[model samples]
Target: MPLSRVVNDPEALTITVVADFPVPVERLWNAYADPRQLERFWGPPEYPAKFTRHDLFPGGRSHYVMTGPEGDKAPGFWEVLAVDPGKSFEVRDGFADEAGVENTAMPSMRMVFTFEATEGGSRVTTVTHFGSTEQLEQLLAMGMDEGMRSAIGQIDDVLADLASFAAERATEAHILSDSQVRVTRVVRGSVEQVWRAHHDADLMKRWLLGPDGWTMTVCEIATKVGDTYRYCWEPEGEGEGFGFDGVLLESVPPRRAVTTEHMTGTDYPSTTNQMTLTPVDGGTLLSIVITYPSAEVRDMVLATGMTDGMETSYARLERDVLVGS
Candidate 1:
């Protein structure tokens, strides 16, 4: 006999299960959409199976087979009714025979999977709808709820593993204008050494932004008032790079330098970066003041933990130059 439904009323027995997993939305969606990933955890222990001909888009079809205790195989088919990548998907379920044809034992069911992004990860809800009350009750009698609970448990394990993997791939996306981080550090190095690290092409490459492939086609700095320079930053690879076109507002070689970093590809407003290097008792006190266009930008920067990113970058610089030198 086919598996019985868990609900009795078509309207009253809508079984909805919501589960939270510590995996990013993209990772969670990929686990369901990708066949290789789906094969790892979509079945119960009693009937281990793999999806066949699985397709994730609307109007697509996926087939699967389950092996019973005596090695008997039961096949099934799912026709995707709607797909919203990384968000939701809906499908109709049917039984299939050994010959890979649809069977008449069970009525078709509408199954919907929805994903909602949470603070740390995502919440996934699966809702299954039966055609009639009798079908729902029939499924429940067959322990369908327990089977679903098992299936969802497998999903939880898969998502936990994926959370670790997704953490490494997280990069902040350019969204609002007011999100930029300002970081300050005190360096136990001479002002000249610190200034050189910021201005010298070789030193800049070693510590700051790039191996950006652009030949520095033009890096001319006046170090003094009334002199301006422009660097035609170009991307090294096939695509166009984020280019900055601005004048040096102030430059005092070993003491202070300020520039407007205006990049074409970034949504961030042009930033005025004023870096001051002062010779203290033993070393140099480096003060960096980054002024954004507005408070919103400042909040954005704080929200993304850009401060932490800056501290990390600066720590790397300290190790590479202060300690290594």
Candidate 2:
């Protein structure tokens, strides 16, 4: 129990919770910046959270769902208002529907999370402001404080497990649901360098080759929304080639991008890929959440050793593109 204090002030229409942890401020900050570690403890023990989208920058938005023991779900959304890197952040937190839209009927609150270095380690103070005294009391009656306490209690375990989320680890994938899978990796480079390596045609050609003998023959890039891009690769000696083409659905330079991908010349179902880059303690955290058409398609793609190929290409990116940059 790292919780040090909890205060509810009806006069100010606010509630504050303070928790301390025996970890560096950077470690504590990364636990929240990376969605993988955040989802581990964002909800109570019985109700584990799954963050489908988490962007910590100002004006960004995050969506998560907590599923109870009996399969009941509670969805929530956060609209980030301000961010000060590892120091603090402010967000408008509220309940949401299954599609992640805000539920206007419920009371929303403004919350500020402040992180600071303490004598022993670090401390995080969270102050939540309600719209009115009635909203404050209503949320209290709904056990909001207790729920927060329970959620913070699990952070210690996540903080201590450093190796599992280390930057040197290979690319890893987590099945978020039957049709959604998130692939994550931390590379030794700045977010800008990594993002450019992905968007620039010359840089991508230098590192996107999956295997040793394969060479990228075509590297067309889509820089803006509604543009389509194509890429093809072939064995250096003599072998059949493969390629993928996609349309850029959304693009936020140096932060996030969304695209729809399918086999180059096939009529197979397409997948929606959402890629997000987050700066962390060690390096840039690259997370790609792919939504397949169905569970069968998701499983089939995994069986094709997708993660292993991605790891190879990312390693090349660090060795050839990022290192020189």
Candidate 3:
């Protein structure tokens, strides 16, 4: 992928570049809205970015550390000045301490991105202004220009990988019939990793838990067809909250499966689930078609934040298990 065209004026102490992404404006905006997306292109290929703290609100400082091959962390902070969702944002960029606090000792720059629609996609014009010639020299000496170009180069790959997943996230779960609720997410990982993450009890506990406090306490899976499996979840301290047991109707290794689910405590009727995993261009498209007893029961369950929890759980799955894997 080609890096964004760079223009640097040492005399003016400014760097200006406009990048045109083939993806939609939302995709570009999400690179900043989502930390995981931002980190993918936050730095060059050698120095992978890992965000420690990210808050996009005005006056909130987002900090991330880019780790180099030598195991050194080059921390950077963005002091957000303004945010207009899907349109533009401005921030002060500077080096930061290991603790994520900005380092006043180093030179800083004011950076902004103005997003506008275009025939092909959206055009993002990024402008950076330095305080003085010395400050500009300071950044140039640190290869700021080259690093910025390298960082921007990775945006296309990152967005392409997330296009399917982002599309699914933007859409609400569709009620296919009177009894079924379907949710799909295209996650970035090999079929093997995706299969393992979903089937492995220990790995499921790592990211399957919704929010933070709740956890999947018990995970019992029968590997073969016609066998039964059960999963239990409860609050860390509180007593049991919810669980489900299922008998495997069919199994196709990492590709597809059908199961019958029975609720443990809830009055809702049993559910049958068909999990289909189709290998897409980037990864696997995971579709979970779950059938409840009736539309009333499905609606009632959806009202209890099950859809939101599922979205959160899938996001955690992508962030914790997929992506760079």
Candidate 4:
């Protein structure tokens, strides 16, 4: 119902859909920039989406799976091509296998999403360019048009619910899949400051402490890919100490980072952590997606009140490090 028009042009080999919303351009733009909001309406009603990774910057990639009523899943990915914040972005959209690798046999398309201020409120136009007429026709026959309309119809509800994703909210964890969990928080700091807080040894020792009475005894910062970082924590008076060491897998500066984390002195399997930061209305949105070795491991970690501890640390970060700086 939000769609004003849907055009399939054979000569141009493009499918364009225009939709209008009764919200400001920023509100509409945030829905896509933030993965939590994006997953809510990225898929049709029958196939709800779960975004495991969503990086809105150029050269970044997003991976999501749409689960059907019968528990079947269809995975897809997007390679971000360009971005003009609050205005437009282009991506190479394609189908993917269970591993999130693109299926070359299937056709992929270039998609351009444009957002603009309208007389009423705002408008969004999506132009999907196919490689050939055959590919476009193939996609249309696969219910692409109806699927898009169904997906956009759910955006109204998502936009109306502002409190759910508010910046003041505490840290929360979402189960992205059997082996993946996404933890999110909006800290009262710029993206650069938040990124630095995680990297600078002194800055980290000040706020990365959870709860109280615990001191970070060791903080070895990882400055580049392939570098290994270690962090150890000990109680002020008495308790068993703990530590974690990880190798930096990827680093994109103030925007994103990926690392392999392992508990020190433990033989347990390692976990891959992917963190992304985006500037939102109130502050910077920090999203970390952790891929565990198994569902049991993921559940066990979450059952240990991981999010609660994370919330405590984030609060300390804002109160101690970012408030004035």
Q: In model 4, which regions exceed 4 Å deviation?
A: none
Per-prediction TM-score: 0.47, 0.98, 0.54, 0.98
Instruction: Estimate candidate 1's alpha-carbon lDDT, on a 0 to 1 scale.
Output: 0.62
Query: What tens digits encode model 3's per-residue C-alpha lDDT throughout 203-291?
Result: 89988887778978789997888898888888988665788887899776776678998887666568888766644444555667677
Per residue, candidate 2 scores C-alpha lDDT tens digits across 223-275 of: 78999999999999987999999999998888999999989989999999999
Residue 82, candidate 2: C-alpha displacement in angstroms: 0.8
Instruction: Provide the clashing-pair count of each candidate structure.
Output: 12, 0, 0, 0
3 or 4: which has the higher TM-score?
4
Error of 1 at 236 (Å): 34
lDDT of each: 0.62, 0.93, 0.76, 0.94
Better of 1 and 3 by lDDT: 3
User: Model 4: what TM-score?
Assistant: 0.98
The reply for model 1, stretches above 4 Å from the true place, is 1-11, 160-325
Give residue 123's error in model 2 in angstroms. 0.5
Candidate number of the best lDDT? 4
